[model samples]
Target: MTIDLPEYPFPQPTALEPPAEWAELRAKCPVAEVRLASGDQALVLTRYQDVRQVLSDPRFSRLLNADDAARVTANESGGVFGSEQAERTPVGEGHQRWRRLVGRYFTAKRMAAMQPRIQAMAEQLLDEMVAGGAPADLVSAYGFPLPVWVICDLLGVPDSDRVKFAYWSDHMLSLTRYRQDEINAAQLEFGEYIWAHIDAKRAEPGDDLISDLIVVADAEDGQLSQMELIGTAQGLLVAGHETTANMIGKMTAMLLADRDRWEQLLAEPALVRSAVEEALRFDANPGFGMPRYLTEEIEVSGTKLPPGTTVISSMAAANRDEEAFDNAGDMDLRRTPNPHLAFGAGPHSCIGQALARTELQTALNVLLNRLPGLRLDGSPEELPRREGLIIGGLERLMVRW
Candidate 1:
């Protein structure tokens, strides 16, 4: 008997939550062909096992055919954060060098040390939110600022330039208003800005990631070029801030929507860490997933995916696979052996996950403590969501104490 494949309404990266259809897809076609908005053929992986394997397995590569790579890396019009050569470069030694140079600074140890500072930043942001009074938009006042501040602090970016950086970062990730030209321009401009900082740090070395990268670039032969270093910095700046910010907003909103869970968390503050993990599992931005492309024809879960086909692994679907988790839809803070792929898997697993977890735990704790009666100011259904973006999050999260 032939099984019916589930259909997803929005584009792969478009935000439309409660991906109920994905359950059917996971069961029916662990791997299936899907059409992209650009009218290209793409493969979709829904099952936890299949998605995890693809991510960890080196057989399926990050680079696609030249045409597909161009399309994939093309900047959105009106974007302030530009595209980089690193993104355009297919698999090569340069890629390895770029990864190694940045990886050193983002080591687990460094991220652990940043936890205390992240917590402090979260607390300071929440303090400001409390001072702002009731019916405040958490997204604007706290959720967004915490990650931005933490990233800026780590990168040694001046606080005065944060507003501009924030704007550039948003446009960089935004798919709606930005075209390739705009994104490329923004990326070049940002690269120049970072290079200037790197140059300054060379003369008067600072104790920061950028300074560290500068040292590596200067000392190592063929490790990283000046532009490459700038590109790395820009990439870190964007990733470090944007993804965490959205996750913070989405996780908080998810908790608020489920009052019992919210109350449970508030009552047992110790559960904050697990609660964050569960939230990460339960309410992942539905449309966003890691993108891969087949370097050669490969069979995935009985499906023959041709070379150059774009494959999207739905992390949201993988996390909620019923086969993997009992009552996968439910938020259980006490969940043990929960192996959610929220940080993804393999060599490309999120580098800042440790710091991100700390930020979430700290933010949630401070918010619940400072505002015991914290409740949604408006209906969740009424809240507007940003569209045409890979990351899923609310435009604003208005709340009251």
Candidate 2:
């Protein structure tokens, strides 16, 4: 029996937990049907194995997904990075090329090597937040600033531009929240910003990722076109800060939900890493799933899907799956073999995950040590959440020491 799924951009649940509907679907029908905001149909994969299978399978192509007419609209080109289609490079080999090119610069070794720098930045931000006294909005005081600084410094973006970038990121990533005209306006300004930044790097390169890409572009047989270079920069700039910043605010909010979680982390700094991982798994704020277009007929758990079908693999639901996890609803800091899809998996997995982890771990350690009395200013229900957007996160996180 097929289910007529509820609208996508499913209303923000009052709590941080994944939707109750997801669990019901996972048990009764893992690969249930869904109706997107555009009135287009899709499959929402809720089960852990099924979600992973969809993400891992090459038959489910992102490029093909973008090529669909049903998804393309005035507001979106059905972009994976939440930007215009032409603004990005191709997937498949293009994705591999991106991974290879970026792997050299964003390696785990490179991120590990930058730990001291990341930690120092965290301390500097926290110091200012401490100076501001208590009852500060963590989102602005620490969360937003930390990643914006780190990513801008990395990409060699000017100090003047981070604010503008944040504004653009907010408008652009809000897929359903903003109108088509509003998104288009943002896209235009964002594209202009990236192109200008690229040109600046071309004129005088620096010891940064954009500069490095410029060098690669100047090399013979280099595959990176100017558009691709600009697109890549935009991707790093927007995603680089937006995702990590929200994660920081959300991570802190999650910990503050329970004083025991805070005490446990304060007692053992080593546990901070696992705490970050658990937070990643526990947070289901990125309410909308990444869209993948099917290239061939496929099926999972006795349900068959035809070619050209759209599927929204539910990482939120899968991560909380009872079959894959014990006490699935609980946040367990000590869970071993926890294959959470927080960073996603397969060819299209998040490329800057290492840096994200470093940022998160550093943020957690700094917050706990520096603010002994840090706790939520209000209960979860009293706090507001982002609505009508692809991302799930708090509107503001007020905390005090």
Candidate 3:
């Protein structure tokens, strides 16, 4: 049956605005059909409760490599969706074990301890940006490098190799950008690089996550396989670098889009934490949301979804659902008890969330303290949206102080 479904990433008037379809879908068609970049159809959950349920439930699995699952992209290998690394990721009990191994390093206490270093990195980036003078592209000047440096330090990755990491990440995140061959080559290159790095780490372990994982894996009896080790390193590098990098850019753009928001934070420094949460919840362009494949027949929002169904949970959409938050459209910097799903939900929620939060809070504080005069160099509507990636971000966030 040929279904005339609207495209998955609905058209937006600007980079920082949500698609009109999100509000409409939540209102009338909470569970709506949409076509992906691969031209395959999947059901998207826009309502807060439905999205939360799908993500938190065990039945909606990340096993998108199934033969019957809808491919997320048109690439022959489905980009990151059906990549070997994704396939190698542990599931069920194995997944729980994997999370346990990685989660220990990302606890709130550890992230808090690392805040000073994160703040220093942010300060250095901001100093460099200021040295370059005004009308700078914040995305390039401050946003991208901060998270890259932090993640690289965490993984024992050399700072000199950041350019390559960026390239490999972009290729792996292809939605409609690179050709199949290009994507394949990038993955191969990234895998080879990670393997080589792992070999180096094995010989001389360092005080980093990769080295720590190597030690743990060596001690464990069949707990983390060699492939799992490689997948873990690769996954951390990409997830730790890409999403956070894009978010720093998006978060800054959101604040500067409204001077009052920026002023609000500067006036009440205590609001930094809550403001970051609000920004996460209020983000209109968070790129391709988390995708889950159904393992069995299930009902969501009174709709029955059968086995083999591929459902995309629009966390960004759900974050803005009126039913979930008071004045869902308003950006409340003081919003308390804010339980936004920006890091996702359930067992599969982002493990590095604490680290992400630390980086974000540190970055915002450093910026507000150092450059209270900061303002956008261009209008919000004039900003260009980054294209061809599952994650959404601004191509360039021009700013001045």
**1-401 per-residue lDDT for model 1 (tens digits):** 53343333233322225655577788876776665544455677888888888877666665445544322322210000112212344245666566666666666687777777887877787788888788898988998888888878888888668787766765555455577677667766776788888888889887788888787778757566676676667766776666667777777888888799889987788899888888778864534466677777877787777777778777778888999999987889888777888777765566556666777787888778877788888776676776665455678888998
Clash pairs, model 3 backbone: 287-392, 288-390
Quality of model 3 by C-alpha lDDT: 0.80
Reference-based TM-score of each model: 0.87, 0.92, 0.94
- Regions of candidate 3 where Cα sits further than 4 Å from its true position: 66-88
RMSD of 2: 3.6
- On the 0 to 100 scale, the lDDT of residue 394 in model 3 is 81
lDDT (Cα, tens digit) per residue for candidate 2, span 143-254: 8888888888888997567789877876766657777778778878998988888888889989999999888777888677676787778777777777787788888988
Off by over 4 Å in 1: 1-16, 64-101, 284-286
How much is the lDDT of residue 91 in candidate 3?
81
- Least accurate 10 contiguous residues by lDDT in model 1: 76-85
Error of 1 at 317 (Å): 1.3
lDDT tens digits by residue: candidate 3, 1-401: 78788987787789889999999999999888899887888889999899889878976677567432212321111111112232236888887888888888889999999999999888988889899988899888888898889989999999789899889878877788988788889889998999999999999999999998888778748788888889888877777766777778888889988999999898999999999888888888877776788989889999999999988888888999888999999999999989888877777777777888888888899989999998888789989998887767788988889
- Per-model RMSD to reference: 4.7, 3.6, 3.5
| lDDT-better candidate, 1 vs 3 | 3
